[model samples]
Structure formats: structure tokens, C-alpha cells
Target: MEPLSAEEIRRSFVNSTKSQVKSMALPAKFTELPWESLDFLGWRDAKAPNRGYLVVRRDGGVTGIAVSTQASGAARRFAGLCDLCNTAHHVSDVALFAARRAGTAGREGNTVGMYICADLACSLYIRGLKELDVPQGETAAPEVRADRLTTRLESFVQRVLA
Candidate 1:
């Protein structure tokens, strides 16, 4: 994935009324992040913690989402297995972070996940894919299906930030 410029990021988030394109602060150690490991365009925020970053792609059009490693104390009442990989996250592996669509609809602060390596693609990896091997006692609804999981997470992130 190619790195995105600040202008590209700002333009992508034109629809997000609530989201602002500010520099992210990243931890100094995070400088070693493997950009090549990502599938979509990703970048670390220079002004904020190094853990702060953004990922962008053309889901239908130019859709960009922001991500941060900062954790929230909000308790998790909702428990469900990942629809894609079928892994159990005990509400911890699954966290509610903030995000927003990068276009006209970008004002929404959606919630997303972090530390989701079970599926390997962060949000999408944990969300079940066709090849995923779901574990026993783990079930997901159509609304929480793998494909929709990422989008749902994004919405959750928006709510948290908002």
C-alpha cells in the first residue's frame, strides 16, 4: 500500500464534518512499524503519538478511516465472536476506537478494533472471511458478519470520537 499525503487524507475526509485532519502523535518506538504489512494505504500521524495512524481505501469511492492505539475504559456489554476468523476476543482484544469516513459522510466518529491479529488484517482480519475457521460456541449474526464488521466498527469509532 502506498503512503497517503496530508492533502489526500484531507480530501478523502471531506464528508466527515466532525473529523479534522490533524497530525497524529506516534510513539517513538513505533517508527519501526512495517508499512508493507498493511493492505491498504496507511500512515502514522507525525504530531501525535506514533500509535495514531490512518488507513484508507476505495471501498466504493475514496474511504479513509483514522485509527489510534489509545484505549478507552468503556466497558464492553456486547460479546460476540469474530465473524471472519471466529476468534473469541473476551471484549478486550476487541476495543472501541474512533474513526470516520473520509468523504461527505465523514463527520461520524465510528468505533473500530485494535490488536486484532487473529485474522491478520486488523479490523477485517478478525471479521470472518470465507476461509476462516470459526471456533465452537462462537456465532455471529448477518448484521455482524465479517464483511459488515469493518464498516460497523468504523461506525462505532465515530460514535466514540463524537
Candidate 2:
């Protein structure tokens, strides 16, 4: 992944309005992010825990989406795997986050949701930068896992765009 500026990130959002983008907050220490180690930029809004953001570099451009957590009762009772990273997490560590669809579909209240790490730290988890008490149970190399994470994440983003 390449480093992104605040302006680029704001402009890349496809499902949010100018005012919403203007109000969205970047992750803390945004300038110090480890870009090379990130598959996509993701974080919960500093001021609004329910709101989350994901940004990825595709072909030659960037795409970003704003997502919000679903109501709490939807969480699983046992450990769950993250759809994007295939990482296992305690029930409390995973949550269902939903993003409104892009364009007309979004205006109609359509949304897409998937179970993912609550902290939006899939990249770090995939790269072993973050410690997990339980194993991911995959035999792939870190690079391969990273590639898979990017593919899955992009697919989810595509669904939102569709």
C-alpha cells in the first residue's frame, strides 16, 4: 500500500457526502502510519466508535468507504473469523460492520455487512504485527496472506460499490 494524504482519502470516498467526508476523522498519528505494512487503511472514528473507514489503492486510484457497526446483539457467541483476513478472534473482538452501498442503491438504504476485527486491524493481524492469542491456522506465507487479505477486502469494497 502507498502512503495517502488527508485530501486524497477524503476525495476517495464513494458512499459519503462532502459534508460527511469533511467531518470524518483520520486515525491518530495518521502521518506516521506504516504504509508499506498496510493492506488497506482502516480505523474506527476517534470521536464516534460506531463509525469506521476503509481505504484501498486499486489499479491506479484509491477507493474509500465509510461503515458503521450494526446493533450489538448481532455479534456471535463464539470466536469468529474475519472475512477479509481469515483471522480468528474472540467473540468480543469481532463485530459486524456495514457500509451503505454506493450511488442510487445507497440512497435507497441498501447496505453490505461482514464480520471483521473490531479494531479494524486486519492488516496488522495478517502481518503478525499484532499478537493474537490463537493461531490463524493457515499455512500460507505472510506475503500470500497479505495478498489474500487485499483480494477479499477489495471484493467487499466492490460489493459496496455495486
Candidate 3:
């Protein structure tokens, strides 16, 4: 993934209103982020804990969406995998989230929900930066996992826009 400027990130949003983008906060370590190491940028909104954001470069343009974090869906300490990156986490670190559809459908209350990392840091989790107890015997290499992350995330974004 390439480094994205604040302007680019703001323009990337597909599922959020312009005002949402304008008011949204960047991750706390935005300046120190290692952009070259990212498969996509994702973070829980600081000012609005229930809100989250994801951004990626797709087909020559930047694309992004707003996600709403609901409470944890799993009752056990460790349960399901994050739908995007397939990383296992303590149930408390994984939560249900939804993205409103991109247009009038969203205005009509349409949203797509799934379980994802509580911090929205699938990129770091995959690379071992934010460690989680991954299940044993998963054999895909890091590069392969990164590719899958981007592909899966794009698919989710498409669902929001579709």
C-alpha cells in the first residue's frame, strides 16, 4: 500500500457523507504510521468510539467507508475469526460492525454487518505488530495473507456500494 495524504484519505470515502469525513479523526499514530507496510488503513474513530474507518487504493482511486462498531458478538474469551483477515482474537477484541450502503439505500437504513477486529487493525494484526493468539497450522505466507486482506476488504466495500 502507498502512503496516503490526509486530503487523499478524505476524498476516498464511499459510504460516508462529506461532513463525516470532514469531522472524522485520524488514528493517533498517523504521523508515525509505516504506510509501506499497510495492506489498507483502518482505525476506530477516537472522537466517536462507535465509528470506524477503512481506506485503500483500488483500481487507481482511493476508496473508503465508515463502519459502526457494535458490542462484542461472541461470548467466549476467544471465538470467531475476523471476517476480513481471518485473525483469531479474544472475544473482547472482536466485535460486530456494520457499514451503511453508499447511497440512498444507506439513507433508507441499509447496512452490512460482520465480525471484525475491535481496533480495526487487521493490517497490524496480520503482520505481528499487534499480536493476537493465532490458531495453529495456518500456512499461508505473510504476502499471501496481505493480498487476501485487500481482496476481502474491497469485496466488503463493494457490498456497501452495491
Candidate 4:
């Protein structure tokens, strides 16, 4: 995914008077993150432990969601993995995020957040630097790919908030 502009991100929160973009407490090493690696902006708040948030701009609007470093403690009943890249994520890598959907049919509720490898350097294992090995091929099942992407999206969301 492409990076979103600050103005685009700001416009996403126009509907929610209660929502606001707060500064993230990124590790000093990651302070100079490049813009291209991000699909949206995510950050974690020092005041709140294990709490983070993400802002994704899509279809001319943005969707902001709150994320958590901890897992939901739920198992993955899904069959597929990530669509972009074929990789299987353990259940522990997934969590849930809450946000208000954009547009006329939008609703406010919880959404799934999963952590996958994409070099956000947000995961503790990577220490905010270095990329993990995500397989490059079309051998994995589509379901597995989709499931992986879902989890990865969640992970990416968490990193943005972190």
C-alpha cells in the first residue's frame, strides 16, 4: 500500500469530533522512518501502556483504529493467510482494533488486528529495525494468504500506532 498524506489522514477524522491524531512515542531509532514503508500512520502512546492507533486512507477517506500490543487470546479459526505474500502467522500475532468506518454506511465497532512481517520494526523481535523473511512464491493456499494478510494488516496497524 502507498503512504498517505497528513492532510488525507486528517480529513479521515472529520466525522468523529471525538477522534484526534495524537503523537506517537516511537523508539528513537525509528524516529527517521521513511514515508514509503507505511500504508498509513501508526503510533503508540507513552501515557498508555500497550496502546496504539492507526490511520488508513482509502477511497478518498481515512479510517482510524485503536490497536493493542497484546493478543486477544483467541485462536484463528480462519483458513487462509495473507494475499500479498504467502506466510502463516501464529494466533498470538493477531488482535482486535476499534474504529469508526467511513462513509454514509459507516459504523463504529471492533475490527481484527494481526501482526505479520513487513519490516515495520515495531515488533519486539525485530527491535524496530530489520525485516523478517516472508516467503516469495505462489505455493501457499489462497485462504492462507488472505488470513496472513489480515494478520499482517493488523500488525502494520499496531506498528503505525506504536
Q: Which should have the higher TM-score, number 1 or number 4?
A: 4
Model 2 pairs whose backbones collide: none
Model 4 scores what on Cα lDDT?
0.43
Question: Which residue window of length 10 is worst by lDDT in model 1?
Answer: 125-134
* lDDT, each prediction: 0.43, 0.90, 0.84, 0.43
Each prediction's RMSD to truth: 8.0, 2.0, 1.9, 8.2
What lDDT, from 0 to 1, does candidate 2 have? Answer: 0.90
* Model 2 lDDT tens row, 57-106: 99969999999995445545577788888899877788899999999999
What's each prediction's TM-score?
Answer: 0.40, 0.93, 0.91, 0.42
Model 1 ranges off by over 4 Å: 14-19, 23-32, 41-54, 59-62, 66-71, 74-87, 97-162
The digit string of per-residue lDDT tens for model 4 on 24-114 reads 3433334465555444455554665466555555564566655555524554544333222343344334333333333342334424445
> Mind giving the per-residue lDDT tens digits that candidate 1 earns over 49-109?
3234444454444455555555434646545454323455545444333344343344444
Best by lDDT: 2
lDDT of 1 at 157: 39
